[model samples]
Target: MKEKTPISLHEIEGVVVGHRDGHGFIVRDDGQPDLYLPPNEMRAVLHKDRVRARIVRHDRRGRPEARVTEILVRSETPIIGRLLYENGVWLVAPEDKRYGQDVLIPKGATGTAQPGQVVVVELTEPPALFGQPVGRIKEVLGDIDDPGMEIEIAVRKYGVPHQFSEGALAEARALPDKVRAVDRRGRVDLTDVPLVTIDGEDARDFDDAVYCEPARVGRGKGWRLLVAIADVSHYVRNGAPLDIDAYDRATSVYFPRRVIPMLPEKLSNGLCSLNPGVDRLCMVCDMLIDAKGEIHAYQFYPAVMHSHQRFTYTEVAAILQNTRGPEAQRHAALVPHLLNLHDVFRALLAAREARGAVDLETVETQIVCDEAGRILRIEPRTRNDAHRMIEEAMLAANVCAAEFIASHRHPCLYRVHERPSADKVELLREFLKALGVPLTVPDAPGPRDFQAISKATADRPDAPQIHQMLLRSMQQAMYSPHNVGHFGLAYEAYTHFTSPIRRYPDLLVHRVIKALLKDGRYHLPVLPVPGEALAKLAKRLQERGTSEAMTRSRGRPSQEVLGWEAAGLHCSANERRADEASRDVEAWLKCKYMREHLGEEFTGTVTAVTSFGLFVTLDSLYVEGLVHITELGGEYFRHDERRQELRGERTGVRYTLGSKVAVQVSRVDLDGRRIDFRLVRDDAAGEARPSGAGTGEPSARRGMAASSLRSAKRAGPKANSGKSGTGKATPARATRGAGKAAGAQSPGSGRGRRPRG
Candidate 1:
């Protein structure tokens, strides 16, 4: 052991950060940065392995310093995530932290795991003599069950996919794809129907088509709207490859960069995609509605349509708004019809409003990435009128489809959103009462009830908070063969009859629509065999969920975390990964871009608060960076999770998520995906008033101060002391870049302050 080492401090265990030349782990000693764990001695240690280590040699650079004397814990594990048969051997690769090397299962222990299948494994023996670690297969998941399955596998292998299957793929490749002449013999051949598909500029697969014309109801005073959807089942018959894949997927997985479609490309992109000018099959919902948006007459049929024009929402909106320039003229023939469509949409919107449909208008951030999958920027994409207009049309069409299917006495999967859980409702009720917010909830407050409550608290200062709470109190919608009216849409009946390319349920609905039109009975999907590898996947997912649910009750720790149900936790974790990956790619690009401005000032919002630091969200560019709370001022700042605030001891000023402040770029960590910032007064933030500061609603920045609190360090620099080497404070001018009044200094202001390297 090295002499002069701080004696009697807790014998700190070492954590392996990296490995070198089969020698051992490169461990780090926390308190002292200039020390590391040498190899050969660290053979038992692994990455993230905590060990009892002591200082042997302190390098001048302060790292490469320690020798691990004992392995406090074994880092190897039995349960592994990615075990499969490879090169005549069963190899188990774990998908967890620590990233340990793969374990090879003996040929004698092959069990049920197949080549190219995702299976869990258990290590029986550790690696020896240059041979891999050994294990046996525990379970296997079927070939990534479509889109949802891929995500599930990806997340799980990451220790996170939150989805379930209904034994749908068990009945695979049993049916045909193309509609036979015998199949078409009984169905209506509405090949001449003037149905057109309206989608986005980038849409590839068209699911539903519409043919709306003027009609009179209630004594000829209302207009009749016809909503026709692509009859997908006509082409993709029961038990076909397309059907099997679709059913397995359950839903489409839409990644930011690409989509793993539920159906095969041959089917999703070719046979059933409903491309314009092609003679495509579809299930039609013909509804005769009045001016009051009530359906007076409706009919369901199996029909064929040659989509007249594949119109973009932008083009439709342009025609409807009468900005018929060259772009609108490109699709000139549909102008009058599109206008009539807008009229229908207007009426539907009114009906929706009258029904008290919630206008949940949260903007979504679209990530722009470069060729190498690095994020270019994060910007809010506009959901223009065209988007809403198409949405209204789809909603009406889905209602008509659901009503037609139900009226015909056929059973099908319904998109159902149940009322909030009893516990949630009770908690919300108590919370509302405490906040003095009056709400008249029925025995069960549905979407309309939530809407009423939101409207009541609209103008209140706590509107966002209340709205967020109420939103959280609602139950998420899910799919079931049971027909329960949708609560959120305020509809008596609803099913997804659109977007079959993205959702398997919608394709199933289309199948049922065709089945009923031809007078056929509904067939149940087949499930996996008992004790089969596939069954283990479903069972394993359930078990994984149970295990995770137990951990959620332990409460949260760090940032990028919220709640912990199996599904919720999985989604949250995946969301964090996605966000981090996106942020990493963006930060790399942004840092490369921001290198142009070394001493620039930018305005930002306080996005998060922690005991150690605050995260600031830049307003102009939307880039986020950390502002260590320790750098708040000369005095101590205390954090209060209850009030979501950080209070200054003497100034009494508080900072929270929405608190506005100008910050100067202090440092950047590209590989670590971090951008550091230091808070600046408006005067130092430059004349460019962050566009809108006071416009943002005030956050609850109410908290207590850390008055008279002392640092854990004997002589540490005060917060934001702008110091350099070994706790010497960086100069005020260099630290506060854009120029603000010099901050106050204390006894610990200039000496022994640590810069987070």
Candidate 2:
């Protein structure tokens, strides 16, 4: 008899991610592949709960399957869902299907929430092997279709801190409405600088103001530029109630008609805001630039500045276009200075080009909502010279800030954007080669390589598609104490220093710069945040330590370095969180808008192609929906990864990234934030029908749709009819933009810019 060896089990700790289906997975904290948990193993755990699991066996597909060993932490996040009663029992079905389990609500635990109304639930008992989780209604939010309900649900669903703590609110209330004398002590007076804020029309929190004038740089023709950012650190002290609340939120969340501010309105919109004709404390980045647009020298200092005016992008652009026009006449007193700023901007732009920074253009849309909180329309936002000017100024200031900190050997967070991974670069090269584009992508490419490709393909019909692929090939920028340089911006060092009023990292930057100015080191206070809040951050820091830049550094990371790393991770994660919440609200709004036009046909461009379907963005409405593979035609379609397209095997019809098509909206799943579209075939009948239908096609081809429907039926009614082109459960928000052009917007700037890379 042969003795069999016992299977060695691997134990892992991770957060539970539940699917709408009975199955779930453990998203391992060690950055390894997720371990699948079948319906049986998921019985005793809920979504987002921390758990330690052991790999019991590998599935037939060679995937590791795990069983729950212990529940380390039950997620305290409140669940947002609708309260329902049926079969002599009350329960709440979570709005976010990821929760997977219906929470049972006992009698009297439903509170004031009515049946079918959306409510917030707090778990009272964890799920057992054979029982559903039990919870009590914690807050009654209102009807599912009420105005602003999406925002309400999103804030809670994503755990975004929407309400200010009582102590923070009290502290804000006690602060003076105007800058006081003591607050301005030892600060350089910049009230005479004629600094003016340039922002969007609806901007409230004016975080940055700029002033520029012709000056002598070592007896050469040059310009002196001043970028004064709101000093949020002065008002929100470290570890205070306001600071704690601000840290919790990390960044302000912007929606269509609302903003969930990081700090209270008193700080975001009043005292710290550089409102026109008001004295405000600021951190100034004063730079001397010569004819070439390169910085000759720079200095940072605390300042008391008064914004001479607040100009919108449109107005500034109009004035710059024609100094004698009506728009220019209104701001005649500031015309000459504006021209100097324009000259300096041109010089800086030249420098940017010389540095070979990646500047990919993308379309950004703004949602127009009416009084009822319903979307009226979606309009493409325009960017002009004024926007670019402000962007260049902010960029220059940020670079200087990074250099200043590095010079002082300060342990502060740097905005890091590393080069693309080898795999992504290879994929991009193959894609470009498949398209027959006359360009070469090297294994180790720099910002110049990408910029060159963008320049070469600018006139192509598929330029937007190619640009999107380039953007996707790059890695997302993040905050880190270990500076690896910003690949997208082509900067050796960069840090966010312009919008402290909205971004917590910028506030930290202000503190560090202040400490450096005083010839002292800034010590991070023991944050009031929980250890769990930083668990994911710790993992990310550990991962970052393996980067090439980190390996090149000398010594073991200090406590301060680790603390800054944690802060960086927290800020980066919250930034993404805010983005997700905003996108959710937008998607919900778009779904509602599309519902009114069901069965209507519209022409659109195929933005993405996957094995399952094509994602189409309507030209007129700017709304995106999925055209499932089953609805493509009666023929089998095979996805071509290299070409980024789907091709019919029998019929020669092909749909690529830039393909144009007309589709009729078939289904709208508001709950799922999904919209399904059926292709409108071009036939003599001139009627909307699934492609290749009604023809003498083979039975196998004809039965494709039926077979897909049958499969969907077997999967259950709640199964998502179609997924995003990326194979994600939900359709991704239409590509907004990326890189410096798409970076997060400063308070007074144009469309928000994403991190350059």
Candidate 3:
């Protein structure tokens, strides 16, 4: 056989990074840490281009930045921001921040859209010494404040699309509403087997169902496990409209009050949905996982499984708890087995822990709406046994999916989170040590070490603070071709083979699995249409933006040598987008909800402490309202990042995340998508005059305030910090620390705090 050439040796021709994003192209070269583009040498590279370059002189900070020597290829397409007439000369600001400059829109170049409105403008001319690229508006998206406007803004801002092609839509509409008889020809029929879907009460699209039975192992041990995933590939063929759309999206974006689904509603909520009593096709992961939580043997096959009951998390939890409720007797026969399933879940959960899986339980909030589309509640939904049981089952299936795919030599999208770089991990360890939590092996801190640290500080009142820090220390996960094991989940190999109905990655995995089963080369997952294109644009913009952000900062330029940075950036941005969208919707609804109770007070906990203000989660309403830093108390407070707390200089009363207090709704700005909460003591909240700027500093201090607040009224820390403070792990508490010296909060940051009646 001929020797395979190293990928590094290949000359990638015609590929160029746009020096100016989505407008013109430029050459970009490879290097570590910061990839530099020489001022004049940055002529041809676009946003993302893979080109060969020669190393120039090192930067001032000792990084090997380079200039592009040649162009390899151009990225997909150009997407420009809306153009507007400024003074007399027309100018349009690029929606993408990476572009870094406004494209000069000449007079008569703009379409019907006036200035201020975001639009898609194309470049008519490349950058010249005197003039920038010229462009005209292609489509006009209204002012950013329109209803559901955030989603549209995000889509345009991130290059995500809202419309499916007429062909794709037509393709979906023509498909049958239910699984055709011929579709189940070769699948196993389990319609009468009593499989049931257990999900949140509001879950409209069910993609999974479980049914467990006790079975004897060879010697005398026993096992109980059954995980059935919607068989997407069985019904949706490769390259079909449904499959194509799903592949493009790769994952469903669940923003509050809305869902941007990978599959169309028809498939997501109807046919492909695993609704109760429906003969839905499923790709079942039938396994005999023993008490050790080890999968003894597993098989994957297409089957027709009927979900006998559609149970909500609340209902299932009640049944499992044997509560005297309607659901307890509704599924009476299944209660015992459900409890058995919970036991098996517990065993598997223990097994997962034994395997060094990092169980990070972050709080998840749900938005509740009334008939008028107003937010009635924004509760922090606790993870009941039902949710954990589902999670455990999914985790088991994902592990098996990873093993099976690798065993079959198949390429697929993996949910991978790599470990932090040695330096960053060291910095994190230093931060922990400075805060009084010492790390035994500082240099090489892995998931188990984190778990150990968490366990050690489990009982501390400062547990939430420490857990938040540890989580921030870890990288976020993303889809990848290579499965190098999930660093966060503590899995050796893992892929999302469940939830094909909502997540595009899972759908793609199904396609890959089917292809692998047929001994075919697995096709690569596509970024949904503009999805990939937008992702490429987003990545370039993010890299440049992050690099720019690094300068004039405290921490070392994030070690790009750690591939996890890219993963983290992607996930973090997605998380931010999801958050922004969710918050926007919830804020709108909450603003509407709060309109009815403007003068009423609600008990809330300080879920977060930031320089900008404190975010309070109400106890009874489950709604989160913001108390501008000015609303904390009638005193000056300094924000301590190292300790993750806000301290009052006059009162010595520090408020950190988990602090409890009562607050009256001061004001809700639906236009700005912001809610203001004043202290329970605020007497003239509505009549009070506007204050200086408020700081948005995250709680990194005041970890010990929980103990102090016991005497004072507090809400949450309501039940517990998501798994972060679980067990007995409690880090040391010192109001003062080594590395970071506390700084006074900027006067502007103390915006909302005012004396209430």
Candidate 4:
């Protein structure tokens, strides 16, 4: 009897990630390698749709190719796009190119939106094999050129909760405008203590205040530091309307000129904010640090504080620089207190260096905007001693919070950052070796090892690039119940104990601390709304392949542990969501800013090297754009993955990270958020000229150069077409152009400092 043919199909479940070029990828739920879905398989699905797919076969390079077998869930997110009327048919083209297909709008469904106006559309029907998705206009967001339109689009696109629920708003409105006598009954009265809040000039919400004094610790001189954080838990009770809203938002999203707060303005800006000369309830971390900067003793307590003064970072820096200066004379009474704080900061910094913490400095730019929300210019934000002083104080309190919860055997979310994976370490080693840098990585690396490499390469011309690579190799920090420790800060335990007014995780920490103080357990109650939804999304984003390993390490977790894990996951996902939304708004603004300088020439340094092109950051504008491979002369170029460079085969000219090159702006696509550049060749020296030599005028040959570049790109490369030097298929075109060009941090409310972890 002839045996049945062996079945070779392997089914996998994953989320669809669409590309601008119509192809897509299935990011497996199991955390395995992603499966490539050709353009045909993506026709029936949109971005972020979950589905079950059968792997038909593997390519020659061992990459899996899949076909969709079943649709699990269609995304419920509303699409944000520009309404277009073409050939007598109404349609909406998604601002996010990953959607791949336009949504068809029926004649009556197009609300009050004009043809070219941006609008939000709710899908009425999902896409089929031969049909497009259909949607109805739900909201009109005004014209494309309207001021603050980018932020409006970003909030909706990332599913950011911008508006507070009615119930939440009612609860906030019912709260007292100031801390009352009844509220101070159970709290220690620290109103007599001369504490102050130092933050950025633009800071609106003051979450923390600090004070320091000299003390005696075991026959040695020490400092007593008090960090007071806004007591948000005192007002936002568990399972309350305010609590639900805060949990849904998870964190506040900061944009260029706006902020979508987690709590209502009544609480975030007025009631909970520790504004100067106001009676505010707070949770204080009172600590005794020895001369060596080690925390000798600590205690947590609720207190009523009256901020003596409000100081900006710039003002504080000036005062500290010259004690007898006019700025210090204005606050002569608080000058000594500031000096004490500075003393403690120095000791803490010494301890940090001794412990071998990873401190990679990066250039963070702040956008200067006009009254109409147009970009005036971009400037690098300068950090001063005042910023570091407050940061160190907050870090110490966070560490104490983590230790306090762990000591009580209570479950809480710990900010954990694991070591780099093996593959990432190997890749980093290969890159360093190719650059002839002397470094040795251990089998199990730690934060100190990475810091050592940074110090050794501090004098190198490519130090910035090397430091960035090190930062990228590290894993992202996330909240988790399991204490894996933070690799970057070299801390055995850490948690967010500051900024409860803005971050939900810090509020949870406060509740846990309060419960421990009362000798009672803080049981996470069942949330009234979106509990299951939050848990599900958190599991999808956080569990990946770690769930099995967690089960293996420890038997099945109890229900309490499970609840904490879900909360951690939800908070982590929302943090990432907030970051992405902020970045998206910034990118849109930068694209708009670059459109006015389309034909100007500028010298820039290569910030990133990829298979398709080099990402160059302009010296004066501080803006980044792409220099496509085809624009790098006529010789065939091959991408070296290990060295992160592109080398020409005929002339052996290489363009690697940190290389300086002159390029003229060739094209700007505001819709695509892309800026393309053409290399400006120095025919006399056959090398790139130094920056500042550009005439800064619109180039006359800009159109001719753009046309030539496009023609060459269409003809494709002569050799190594569709492949890298390692014989791997070139990555998706969308991966190379999007998100890399316009990367900048938003001007956040004094919370822009890198997290301690």
Candidate 5:
């Protein structure tokens, strides 16, 4: 074997990013600014190819320019695109469009792929200084308009591991179709308990079931709650082929019309699923709740249970609404049990409120897709009492699991949500003060402080923006071996223990709980040495989630601590990957849906104000598109970053968040996942009003002024005394670039090379 050369200090390695016009840039791995690669330098590299380069000199724009010295690795991910033969040349244009450069498929390399048909291509040779990258057709994925084609493309584009390994598939196939007698050994017999699964109407895999009944506790009214989660760990042991595959996915990816499950169908939808009338093995969190909705005591155990019924959210909601109605009469035996669950839910809700949990109501939209995978409508998903009941039950169970492990002094991955950082809290306070609704977030503010702020702005016309700002001010929750407690839920400790069939961390939690119940500690698998790939994943996990301090805590044994840290990092990174993949698929679908409504007019709310333009979300379609600042008016508009609004300098006309506007669909770029809208004026002459041209009211301006002052105070050299002027607060729009230069081009239109040093 040839000896590989060691990387030198000046020789940096990074991924190649290409542009439409054949120019490229090296996104350095060391976090330095990207190095410009002109057309000549890019001839040797394709988009996403890893290469080692050296900064030879500076470009005319004073940006660092690099020359490729070696090609380190070619991306193994297959590219999905359409095959086209033009002028005796065969080429494949990538569906993602990020590839920038097209792949050349020779006549003999075309395989069975037809012209204009979608196909997966494997790179046969990296691009050379004078040639394009060469590829061979690996698989035909059908036509572009075929059902679920978008999903197939998304999975490939995001590099989501959707296919199960052959070993995992074989293992799943060999497993019993149903729970066997041997599987019931050493498990408690709760098959007679009327536990039932409550899920969404379209739900297929039932991961959890719940049952509640009245109980006597020390001369007081109490309730016995049984939360039985599908015991996926029993079938898929640690380090097994199934476990490895599940860990690679970490969490299931849910798209509008399809789901990429963490486990094979045989496990997630069959044996491990809590289907009605079937005896399934489960890990039960049995709790005793007082009348006050406080969990007095809890225990975990392995059990076998039969689900009495599988009810949907709508069915449960209707039954709860009217106990004597036809829906309730149909299942009279389960009615009383459901009623008890509802009663316990109300108590739990009261307890939650008393605990000062951060409860903010926000609209969640669901895309309704037809059999052909075309979006029919976008509707707001409403939550009812049934949803709350199930959520509360899950929360109680999760809390108990976290407590069980903590009390036993065993390290485990916790579902952690920390409080907002100091800087974000300061910005929120300043914004609130400008709106005449000042918040007193103490040095050590809790969820209650956030709840108070939410309540004060609940009735405001700009409540959506305010709530959005509040949400942004908080940190995203992630898995961590260190328990900082969940700030949003007002829990001292919390972990995900339900739905192990879909979430890898939950399965790990179940195994830990089971081990603790058997009077032992569950040790995590020994992690392999942190190699280049694993280290990169760990870095991404740290950046996307909790800080490094939480990843590896203090006062823990070396090997045990390292094992938990690795597990936490892996789970967190994969979770983020799943979310990004799902969002990418949804964005693609939404873009496709909006392409049909081009040139149509619709009324929308200004959900975001950027220096470049306004982002309006339509009322009827729930689609959000940008109305670039140039389309705002003929006059000059200035972006006020502090106030989060765009002010037309000439007329003083302001366009802040929550402002309703009429818009016409101007353009849609499916490749870029971008939608553009043009403003539709309702006044005479159909022209937009200038800032101060026709309107004499300066109320909005005054509010903006107060907001500006608050901003200045916070940015001042001296310490802020926490005082803010009273005025109607401006809505905090989505944080996007706010200037004409920033708004001049859509991301899709921008080239790979940016003016940076």
Candidate 6:
């Protein structure tokens, strides 16, 4: 008998990504190109599953294909979805669109969840090549329109750690409600220092209190600024349950009407919160700022301080605007200190400008939610002088903390914002050139150069697009053990030390500072070795600039440095996750709100011009929707990549970024979180191209010849086909005067708009 030869299979680990159309791909952890997985192969695993796959032959597209050999790790995370039954089959459709497949529920696996009811499902059986994965309802999250349902879905959809572990809860419950005398033994007693916390009107957790006064330093007079941060490290010791929970969350996630706090309320809003009229233990950064706004000297120490008052931003802004106002008169004694703080803030602002910080003015909107968690309104959140003053003070304190640790040669997570890459600079230059804007960007541009471009284009018709492109060119800020300097703020060094109550990195900074004050070194608890797949995934995420996960270098390092590196990666990744989760909740809420105003007409500006469609933001509603190319009139529109515009092939009519037009709310897909608009008027499309120039035609009907029609078919008929009579029904004539002589409106101007006042 001939011996049977064994076939050796080469396997690699990667994450599964399921598509809405039932196909799937394996995003390799090793940074290689994604491997294609047909629908047949995807039946064996679910999206986000870490699996070991064997490489199969290449597909027709020359793409490496793979088949799942072994499921290394199931997601195990419960999915939130709505229960449905059709044709004697029970299934759960995930609320998050990223999960493409539905879970099969057995007869009794539905638990107490009824049809159309939202519930959390836990997988009971892993998927097989021919059978669907079976799951049982684990929790009932109530109806879809219940109060705070969006937030609930977001928290679960993004895998946010919402519920505190029993151990963590117990540890928090056992903590004292106030600063004890024994705990303040070695701390400086600044109880009568008259420091005060200034925050928003609705703020509950006060993490910082500030006080400033004129003082003499060296050869000149300076301001003595004291910033007292809640001493979270004192309560959450290393390796404790509370500390573990805080580390897991990394940072608090804030939604419109809710906040998933890092620490339990017992600590975040009680003992560690620097509430007014209460004595709280704190870590203080005492700085002597010269009249020029430079920190001449600084010191850090542990202290017990009492906040004399809690002032809101409105009250402080009113007092600063007019010191003799009623609000200022009400806090007569604190007025002098407030004025001193404002003076210091002015000096700091001048210094910031001198340092060449990139200051891009963006209007931030805040959602005002009612008691039932429905959005009452969304208004621009204007930053007043009081807000700026507090921010400057915090920035100064953070800089001092960073400098202190760096001087001590201690490793800690620094807030780093690296300069833009070479490719980004070239893209921005090309975009600017296409818009006929001057490219004043330097070969190696700093914040000042970008700032110049923004200032020069401030009043231009395409200023919004220009500013947006510039902003997108910059890298996101991240926490790293290495100090790469912050490009946006133009700071040499920076760290977070003021918000320890909500941020884990700030707590670590507080711990390191306290250790430095005591002439000791801070030590981190031992962390388990990260899995090979996780390390590779983290490295890939870091390289793609999508996230900073477990990205510590594999090089052998001293225990302390290794600890700091790992902590930095974890904190950075969690920060990004929190942001994604918060945005998901907001997007979902916005979609729900817009569902009510369907079919209404609203004027909007072109925020982004893509080949597929134009993304427009309504002037007064502040809601954004996509105007598909098909709805841009009965003409084939060709995308101009560099110019960021869409031009009609026949009429040569153009729709560029920042162009304003009237649009009627057409379709709202709540499941997809998408809104679509149809042009109510398109005079913003500009004039037709001359007959001889390019492929310009006088009318949509005569424009598409045999050759042109063939070319249009390649770009998708729904997108580019505009043969008027040959087309079915002529697309309803574009709402009568939709493409009439409406004049163009410049960027940031509400021209041609009839938005609500």
Model 4 poorest 10 in a row by lDDT: 716-725
Looking at model 2, how many pairs of residues clash? 10
TM-score of each: 0.60, 0.90, 0.68, 0.90, 0.84, 0.85
Cα error, residue 452 of model 3, in Å, equals 1.4
Output the better candidate (1/2) by lDDT: 2
Give lDDT per model, in order: 0.55, 0.81, 0.59, 0.80, 0.76, 0.75
Clashes of each: 21, 10, 65, 0, 10, 1
User: lDDT for model 2, on a 0 to 1 scale?
Assistant: 0.81
What lDDT tens digits, residue by residue, belong to model 3 across residues 306-348?
8888888888888877655677777787776677678778888
Q: How do the candidates rank by lDDT, highest first?
A: 2, 4, 5, 6, 3, 1
On residues 241-312, what C-alpha lDDT tens digit does candidate 2 reach at each position? 998888889999988788999899989999999999889999999999999989999999999999999999
lDDT score at residue 579, model 3, on the 0-100 scale: 42
Measure candidate 3: CA RMSD.
12.3
Q: In angstroms, how far off is 167's CA in candidate 4? A: 0.9
Q: Could you give candidate 5's per-residue lDDT for residues 238-310 as a string of tens digits? A: 8888888888888888877688999999999999999999999999999999999899998889999999999
Candidate 3 wrong stretches, greater than 4 Å: 1-31, 35-120, 123-134, 367-377, 515-757
Lowest lDDT sum, 10 consecutive residues, model 3, at 748-757
Candidate closest to the true structure, highest TM-score: 4
For model 1 the local lDDT of residue 313 reads 70
Candidate 3, overall lDDT? 0.59
